[model samples]
Target: MTRPLRLHYAPDNASLCVRLALEELGLAYDSVLVDRRAKAQKSSAYLAMNPNGLIPVLEIPQGPMFETGAILLWLSDTYGGLMPAPDDPARAHAVQWLFWLANTLHPTARMLFYPDQYCDGDAEGLRRTTRQRLSHQLGLLEQASHADWIDADGASAQGCYLGPLLRWFALYGGATDWFALQRWPRLLAFAERAELQSAARKAASAEGLGPKPFSAPIHCHPPEGSAV
Candidate 1:
């Protein structure tokens, strides 16, 4: 850990999740903008780092890492404190929710935001179905029997992940009219609380997200790159 980690990011993209975790962990790192406005993620340099050509790629001592969830989990496990310790009673529940967000909620968001990538026809229909599914998924989170994984100070990597997903749900997916965080009181409450975390505050300032980025999102006016 002699050198700081390097994070390749777009201003308000999924990299924000990794950014939030790094801030919370108090790790100093450098950021390289991917310049989505220029399709920089698809460039040869970036593709070499990640064949999938996604927005975030964390350059660590081991090598360049892709996938937001894997980066978050690695930071948590490598540095600790971002989740319940591996042997703790709460650890299993903590990891489960992290995977659910990554595996379930996140892919659904991708389908909604970039429908063309998921299909060649009926893109609108895909979004229509996805919106309904997103609602039901949020409802499951709202009604989950336990949220100790995320409840304390937006402390886990999952909270960092959820906060951005919440923002994107209202801001992306074509017609956001069907979505409202207020409909799920607990999640809305989580957004309200998550915004107050020091890490979230730093992210807002760095990415031109307003003070209420999570609880009440507006389209980002990033200092450097485009969100889309």
Candidate 2:
């Protein structure tokens, strides 16, 4: 008998990426909602599965896996799709982009979204710095990707990871006015395409994030007299 696949997730969190990947791969997995509002992720039961108390722990037959990038990579390797072939020369490049997203983009976004978690002093200053850094990083990414997706060929796990981050950044990072889609046309186009994917749509709906997650810019300006 096949072992069942399960995912522990929180709505609008990084877990959304994993959900999208599962849906795209046509894998039927059960989803367990983690109550972030109640601090359920920090509970003993959830910490046993992921010591970091993060969202998105995938329970496979072998064991439970944490870390968004690791989960996505494992899923791609095991399922043998949505990624380049193992021996393909482009595989390394693809893997590098995934790591870049995990290490650079994701953490930067966390700082912007939860600045208080990082430091107690100058929260607004921290957000301003993080937003500037993120803008620079996004500029580099825009220059690197001249096509629809990061990988020249087509969409991959990298694109899957990027879609949600971009949407969240635009919506919540307080950079909407300055970091408009018009400035990053290529990245905007890529996000638009990713949003249109069937699996992406399903995953967004499952998370209660709505269908057009990456729709037109919302232009959320920072509060008055804020450092952002």
The best candidate in terms of lDDT: 1
> What would the per-residue lDDT of candidate 2 be over residues 120-219, giving only the tens digit for each residue?
8988899999989988999988887422245343457887788888878877854456557668877777767777888876876565555567655333
- For candidate 1, write residues 106-222 as lDDT tens digits: 999999999999999999999999999999999999999767754565478999899999999889878899998899988888899999989899999999998899989998988
Q: Give each model a TM-score.
A: 0.97, 0.89
The prediction achieving the highest TM-score against the true structure is 1
**Model 1, 81: alpha-carbon shift in Å?**
1.2
Model 2 scores a TM of 0.89
Error of 1 at 214 (Å): 0.8
Candidate 2 total steric clashes: 0
Q: Give the Cα lDDT of each candidate.
A: 0.91, 0.78
The segments of candidate 1 whose C-alpha lies over 4 angstroms from its true place after superposition are none
* Model 2 worst lDDT window (10 residues): 219-228
Query: Model 2 segments beyond 4 Å from truth?
Result: 145-148, 151-154, 174-176, 217-228
Error of 2 at 65 (Å): 0.4
Alpha-carbon lDDT of model 2: 0.78
